[model samples]
Target: MNKNNQKSKDGNWQISFSPIFRYVAVFCLLIFATIMLGGAVLSFSQMKSNAQVLLSNVHAQTSQRIDESITLLESLASLPEFYDPNVPPIEKVKKLDQMSPYFDYLMICYVDSNITVYSDGSEPASLASRDYMQRLFSTGQRQVTDSFAAGADGVTLNYTVAVPLLDAQNNITGCLFCAIYFDEVVDILKQSAATSGYEATLIGSQGQIMSSTAGLPYGEPLMKELQNARVIGTTPDKLQEQLLAAEPGDYWSLQNGSLVYTAYQRVEDTGWDLLCSVDFRTAFLGILPSLLLVAALAALLCLGLSFLLRRYIAGQMHSVDLLVESVEKLEKKLYQDERPENVDFNEIIRLTSDGLSDALTGLVTRSVFLNQAETQLQKINPEYTSALCFVDMDNLKSINDTYGHYGGDVALKNVGYIFREYEKKYDGLVSRYGGDEFVMLLINLDDEAELRSVLEELVLRLHSEIGSAGQQINVQCSVGVSLCQPGMKLEKMIADADEALYFVKQNGKGYYKIHQN
Candidate 1:
């Protein structure tokens, strides 16, 4: 054919395919949009449900801790030594001090009607000015105080769990109180926040923030902080009223240009409220990969239809060059097209695959652990020493062999629990590296002596026997420790710790070793 004739024929084919391509593209786009919208809504609903469950779990745990304090104090109050007039305060304090070892409180003390606080190794101090003490004395009822400075230096924050002591005639004589360090509650909040990617705060009955994982100041009015954030669905005043009325509800707010969802629940038997908040964007992040995959598939379907149309049109024409040119143009367009802007595929990947947590251990996954460790190492203080640890479960295979995989799982769960306890206690990072292996990064240690003491306690705690199917299986672990040095990378520290762990396994299992050189 002549050049003009060929151009006319190619133009005709293009005109014929234009309408079909447009229709297919538009239909695919509509399908993609519908799928994305539905996916987003369902993702948000699932996120809300997850948030509610997390809040409920944290609330129950906080309530249980508070109730435990009250129950312990009440049990102690029933002791005759506390209410007996003949028993001297000094003797009572000695007896209380002996019992203190069994309880988790900082100290157990006896408070007289005059609000005189007496405990072992401390002079009697008058607590007359304390509001909770005054209320307890007046009402002859148990009282739980909010976080307050209680020590001689007036810098230590503590919660007072006090139960009124009654005499034989039912007259109030004195009170039995246990002073709990506020950091204990803070650890609970921190752990829940860390595992769930949320912030947790404990609010006093008077609307004061007793403890917050978000670093909200102690004794700050919860309403004041809410006022600073742009609350949605309700005014801050109404929210404060709901909190004061001990109502459980959820609220959304805009803080620092990010939307946050917060759920509040009242801790039973205490004038306290627990709030759990998370960034709203995270809810969508979990489902983004699926949405992206659906969109990609839709695009491919459209592309495939276009290819079929091109084939049919090419079949009608006798020229092979037109088909080659069309495909070349299509390939160029595919590569030259701009990618979607501002989409963080790395974050999307991280959010998926169990959402940055190990399903079995409830600890951060390896990627998260490495990121956190590197950040902390960069900011490490010279005055404090930090240590990295490699832990290997020694009896996992044996447990699985004898009692089945269920027993092995139980043993690993116990290890997770033990590691988490230490993580909270030491403010460390813990992660499950892979099968039967875990890593821990403990920062801000006072000295090697303190690290040694911690390792000793950890080893002792890990050497317990767990029961499986009416049979006792001994569960143990070997730990390898490496003290972090200046300018050391995470990989090197992990290698050192692994070497130490190898030494322990070679020498004797169920022990710990510090890396040498």
Candidate 2:
């Protein structure tokens, strides 16, 4: 061949390969960009999920603590002794003083029909001017107050729960109340904030801060804080509307020139909200390591694809198609929200209701049980006795090992059904306290003999068989009972019952024992 012709063919080959290299580089860049974008989205979504879980856990814990105060006051109201006119004021005061330690309140007090407050170690003082007092006496209903100056110190911020004392005819007689120090609640928020890297604030219905981990003043309006910080996703007014309506949501904002992400949820059965906030930059950095790892893998994959494209130019189109498909699958896998946003108040309410009951056993969860049981315990007639029963499924582990977890689950379902029936029959409170254990509050039993009879029925009923995997598994529970008095604390009763249960487990299983203490 001529030298010119040879040179021309070599140049043409070089030009052909150059465009292919450009296309390969462009494709690799596209792949890298797609992976990085997906990784970022996934990281942000994950951060939000973590924040939500933290917010939810803190909210539930705080709400439960507040609910106990209400339950304590309501329980005090049901003591017939408190309503008795003949019971001297000094005697009532002494009785309240004795029960003070058990109630975990700053003070347990009695307010008569005249709205005079008589507390342990304090002189009689009229609470007639308190709005909560006026409301309870006028409507004969329960009241949970916002933070205010209370207790003998009369300077420390406190919240109060008051219930009207009703006589035999259901006529309003007086009020039984308890005061919860505000700092105790703030401690709960502080602990959560310290561990979770999110500052938490408890807000009352009027938008005032009840407690805050961020060191916001106790009575400052939340809006005032917002006014100083710029909200990114929505206006302060809109956020206030959401708060006023007790809606659950998340938002972005800028505080002191730093990006912030916040989530808020309404505390159930109370006119309060829980707000959790975290520094956006700091939280984003948490997931940066994972993103970098993903990016490194993507870069290596891009290099491999480049080599394949250079060697197998004929099948480059097919390789690109496969790459696109993989990217789409990754987008689907990475970008999912753990909890869908609630579009309306009704949807939020529905979601809240879903968590109140246990999914597998169809019984109230431990927290729900605590709240309901305390309220019911207070309403029982003082003339009759009540009992707290701790029930442990004796053969759950054996059943799980023998017939698999399905068999153990079948046993629990049966037990739950039985306990639920008893709850309806006795008008009692029943809860699945933990794995393979349950708690029941049997109210208004006439005497120890009556309780024994009821327990016998429960034991015999629980001593049945359940079918699992084409075989029968015997399911039995050991019961420990603690008789309850008017002034007894729920935790003390639980502990006593648990001790008795320990005795039954150690001596023999599948039987019942009353607490000796």
Global lDDT of each candidate: 0.81, 0.78
Stretches > 4 Å off in candidate 1 = 1-3, 6-35, 297-517
Q: Please write out the lDDT profile of model 1 over residues 340-386, one tens digit for every residue.
A: 22223334224346668877666788998999999978867757878
Residue 117 C-alpha lDDT in model 1:
84
Q: How many clashes does the backbone of model 2 have?
A: 1
> Tens digits of per-residue lDDT for model 2 on 1-517?
0011212332321124677667767876787677667766665676577678779779878778767877776777777788777988778888887776786677777888899987655688888898888888888888877788865576888877777888889888888777777777878888877886678888987999888878898789999999999888689999999988888998988887767778899987668889888775556576668777777787677678767866786466456556656755643442343211211223322434777877766678899999988887777777787899999999899999998887777788778777866875677888889999999998877777888999999999999876655687898899999998779999999999999999999998899999986
Instruction: Pull out the clashing pairs in model 2.
Output: 75-378
Candidate 1 structure, TM-score to reference:
0.55
User: Which one wins on TM-score?
Assistant: 1
What RMSD does model 2 have? 44.0
Per-candidate TM equals: 0.55, 0.50
